[model samples]
Target chain A: MPQRIVSQRIVSLVAGLLFGVGLILSGMTDPAKVLAFLDVAGRWDPTLALVMASAIPVAAVGFALARRRGAPLLGGSLRIPTRRDIDARLIGGSLLFGVGWGLAGLCPGPALVTAAFGIAPALVFTVAMLAGMFTFNLLFEAGSRPRGVAKGSGTSC
Target chain B: MELAAFLPALAGGALIGLSAALLVLATGRVAGISGITGSLLGPPDDDTGWRLAFLTGLLLAPLAVVALTGRIPPVTIAAPTGLLALAGFLVGLGTRIGSGCTSGHGVCGIARLSPRSLVATGLFMASAAATVYVIRHVIGA
Candidate 1:
């Protein structure tokens, strides 16, 4: 109801729209293409690397601007992570994500978009992904801070 | 440089990064896809409206593009449906365990210069590269 909330919502919507469009345009939504890229032996598609390279500058500019600006338009201070250490959680998660990507050849963004096309496999992937998320919540519920605490506390926001 | 391939890749990456920047500027929230999707599982709340809207747009944009372009490429999967499902479950679990995904850690997390995100993103990229290698070379899957 607040103007800030409305503005945030609008921005979020726009961001998601653009992300989806990007996935489609990048040819990332195509599982076969992604698989081909992953397939280094047969025919390696290095397009993804180029995409990442191009994205880095855009992300860098965004980060620089947000850092300079300090607080966001919605009235809260930006919460960029300041640490750069490796841990078990990071390693474990990466391994799992890699395996999933290798098998399905569809990461989260494109997976959802492809699902919209009514592809049975994509639908299956989305369903499983949602279920996996739910399972994670159930298993690691304790790690998630209470919403009230997260909102009020300055840590881990 | 093939215009068709090069242009799309450049545009898409830029668009994704721009959207992420806009979301941060507007909402002060990291444009992490996992977090947005994960939020759906919890209890209903007014806060969910924006997340839902964002997700809807993600699904709809492709349809709009396809309608205009008159051709939507078919999706291909190397593994069977069951395996893909299992993999999805694993990703979900990993995200929960790790507290973020590539977008969260790799994009926003790295931007924030969070050590955790950096480590997470590094591990993710390395593991992904390794997995691809193994799958293609070793397993031939």
Candidate 2:
């Protein structure tokens, strides 16, 4: 392995650890806390908003610094999305995600953390989420594939 | 003020930001959990190794806290099993179609000042607030 890959792996591990720790410490992994934050008509908890308010500015600084350099420290280009168009897919999908988020207060990140506890409910949710992803992949492929595609030729997730 | 949640939330939010910053500096990758996890389901990318490593670190974090502090952070889930399943499914499909999630669109994308992310984030937050209102007030779900 090249030096860059090694550095990337180590840094990624550290970043993930920090993220998980933050989620736990911030009470983001708690469904009740998350739900309370979304409960706008009720006694709303502003902690989640505070979390975003604090995180975004700091992350903005990070992004600005990264953009200043020609490339990342590890010789890889940043993968920030360039598409500026906001279409139906984006709005529709976000609405779906929001409904789910409101229903269970478990988005992808905290859902995985919750699953780490080996609890049955979390486990069930995680499995179902994965299954949902798989189903989407199938539907996406079916919809996007060319009409004249060769047999047994498809991308596997 | 609810100092109990406020202080820790601010500190932890800072920590999360620091990690995201570090990832951008080191790997030029956005630390979007949904995008990362979503990619794992598709064809392999060169970044697969780092993704797996990051996931492993995420999974071990709670254990590390328990090891050092002798306490696992509390988690209270109120939704029933069927609802949980449906919600998980919707989240999975939605994140994929939307190409991001709270971490991606809300945090990382907004940090980059992306307009699409801004809209996506706003829409999701608004919709979530609405959904909560409907569930708790309208139908009383």
Candidate 3:
């Protein structure tokens, strides 16, 4: 592998490590803590909001600093999303995601982190999530191939 | 207000931000967990190396903490099995269709000031709040 690939992997590894630690430290790995926050009719805890509120500004500063450069330090173009259009897909999908999030108090990042700790619910969740993704690809992309279209070449964000 | 909980939450949130910043600065990839994981499931492409590495780091995080502190933090889940499965499925499908999740749209997107991300984040938060209300008050789950 090239030296750039090595550096990119290292950077991604370290960044992911820090992100997981942050998730643990913020109590996001605990589904009960998340559920507690979501239970507005019960004991409502606002700690998770505090997590987002704090993380966002710091990320904003980081984004501003990174944009000053032409490319990333590891020598690749940035993969930032450029879409500004909002449609039913965006709203509908977000609503579905939120409902699921509220139902289980686990999303992708936290669920994966929790599963690493050998949590059974999270483990099951991770498997089911992967299955769901595969189902989406099959239903939406796989069978709809045109005459000259290639496999796995459909549009996705 | 528990000062003990407040401090750690703030510190951890800051650490998450730092990580997000570092990824964007160093590799120019949005630290969106769902998108990264979704791509991993699709094909055995050359990009698998980094995604695996990043996930390995996530798995190792608690171990690293345990090594440092000599104890793992406590975690609890109150939802039943069926709900967990259904919710996980919806999250998977929704994130794939929506093209982002909390970390992607909520944190990184908002940080970059993307309008679509802003809208997605708002809608999700509202829907989550509503779900909680209905489940707790109406359904009493």
Question: Native-vs-model 2 lDDT?
Answer: 0.80
User: In terms of DockQ, which candidate is strongest?
Assistant: 3
What digit string (tens of lDDT, one per residue) describes model 3 on residues A6-89?
A: 999998899899999999999888878887787777889988887888899999888887788858889877666667788788
RMSD of each: 2.9, 4.3, 3.1
Q: Give residue A137's lDDT in candidate 2 (0 to 100).
A: 71
- Candidate lDDT scores, in order, read 0.72, 0.80, 0.80
Give the alpha carbon lDDT tens digit for every residue of A4-92 in model 1.
77777777787888888887887788878877776666677778666655665677677778778888877756655444556666678
* DockQ-derived CAPRI band for the predicted complex in model 3: medium
> If you assessed candidate 1 against the hidden native complex, which CAPRI class would it receive?
medium
lDDT for each residue of candidate 3 in B78-140, tens digit (9 for 90 to 100): 778888899899988888677778888888888888887898889877787788888888898
- Model 3 chain A scores worst on lDDT over the 10 consecutive residues at A147-156
In candidate 2, which residue pairs get closer than 3 Å at backbone N, Cα or C atoms, i.e. clash?
A157-B41
